[model samples]
Target: MSQPLSVPESHPPPALIVVMGVSGSGKSTVGAGIAKAISRPFIDGDDLHPKSNVEKMSKGHPLTDQDRFPWLAIIRSTAERVCAEQAQSGEVNKGDRPAAVVVCSSLKKIYRDILRGQHPASTKMPPEDDTQERHPSGAHIPATAALKTYFIFLDGTEKVILDRMSARKGHFMKAGMLQSQLATLESPEGEEGVARVDIDATPDEVVAAARKAVKDMIGM
Candidate 1:
């Protein structure tokens, strides 16, 4: 009889997992699921949006790239901050690497690039000593050069998402604005570190798919 093959143990790396898609595609739900699976904190990008942006969206207006840039910056900074906190508190994965999951509308390639720390616009002023940087939680913020960013893009037909949007209540995003989001979306099909998951199935199925994608990405 042939000997059983040994499977190598996988260790999770320091990473920022961004759950991205147009509104009504279930980013928040999927992101939370992924975060729970990975034992990391989950952040909703909508909460980071400026009051003006929320008001605009509440009034059924689509945000421009200019309006989104600042919001994207906030998202990036928040991810970094979370990773830093994790590191300081020894709340990391088995590999001793910090990780965080976030939900963002990151519909454009440029927006994704900013999250990956590849875009100049996402740059911030360098601290004199990154090791000494402090978060509001009193955690030390270290340099995040080793942190990697990944995206799980929830994709589905407009009709499907529109139906979902119609069913949702009290959301600032209107079902009518789906067209604009689709128009702004540049498919991240070939983009590195992106796992596109189709969201046309039931909520449980979609979350399972997203969790699989995240596990595949992190080798968990």
Candidate 2:
């Protein structure tokens, strides 16, 4: 894992944590573990993908950028909705934010920017004009300020990931797609608010390392 960045003492905890990597990199497992440890919800990005994307992947086709924009938008909106609901629950303390862990491949830097609410063209959702108040229904508020997002990148070799993928069953993403994903991936190294965790260890070890990385990042 990379060295933990020096977060400012006054920085608020992340309101959305994205566990990102190529397929078969244990994003769902590690993300769920982190969410459980942090007392937050876990969302699988695959589950959020539209039916068409799933079908395309099931046929061994890689998703194009146009195919992913809408899906990324949904993921962003979901994170914001979770944050809004948590804020309204009155359970979170002052100056602290409610958080959720989500699994997304998030291969490219542009995709990551969209998730951070930095790319307006990627999503039509408007930013939160007022963070103090939210809709009564806890709708998709798209409050970038209220939702401080971070990414836990599960990094590993393509061979290792493909081997694991071959052993798995009932997953739409085939081992053949790993190459495309690697080609599309823009390493998140040196990017702000990203922590890279090596996935070569056992699942438990990886989870423990990921949790520690997250705690260290958020100053927990």
Candidate 3:
């Protein structure tokens, strides 16, 4: 696509990590594990969904874009707040780097765009990367280069995903919603700035894959 942005010598220590995938894809579970491995705070995107949306999903009904609008805004705001705070401390000059992992589903590209728009282009660089400069393409945009984000897509076979959904208890989204999630899911093809990994593998394997994917994507 536009010669994918090159990863720096060292990652800017991600400020916001959007662990995205269909329902039952182990996003929360895997997001938490990644946060733990990176030693950053993890925020659950589910918790940001409105109660009405939660109720609809709990009743086996899918939420419409309207239902998700506010939730998405809140999540984006949360990521922005984290970015603003990190920027104030002079840690992220080149990208949107957060102090902790704000775990989010970030289901759609528009959702990602919204979150990235929170911060201005002119911001401080992270502790490690001082050559912080925005890519020419994104100079005028709010999210342009000021935000350093990583999108991790938790992927797996239908059966594996269903099994995980079945085992999950007490979550607002029911197992029945799997079909809807699958229907709505837009796989993170090469266009999106995301790294994909299979969720069918063991937890350790998945985590290892995630780490390696991140390293490879950022050229660590």
Highest TM-score: give the candidate number: 2
Clashes of 3: 16
RMSD of each candidate relative to the true structure:
9.2, 7.7, 10.5
lDDT of 1 by residue, 38-89 (tens): 7889988777665556678999998777777656665666677766657655
Ranking, TM-score, top scorer first: 2, 1, 3
Residue 163 lDDT, candidate 2, scale 0-100: 67
Every candidate's lDDT: 0.72, 0.73, 0.58
lDDT of 1 at 90: 60
Q: Model 3 lDDT vs. the true structure? A: 0.58
lDDT-sorted candidate list, best first? 2, 1, 3
Query: What would the TM-scores of all predictions be?
Result: 0.77, 0.77, 0.65
Candidate 1 least-lDDT 10 residues: 1-10
Q: Count clashing residue pairs in model 1.
A: 0
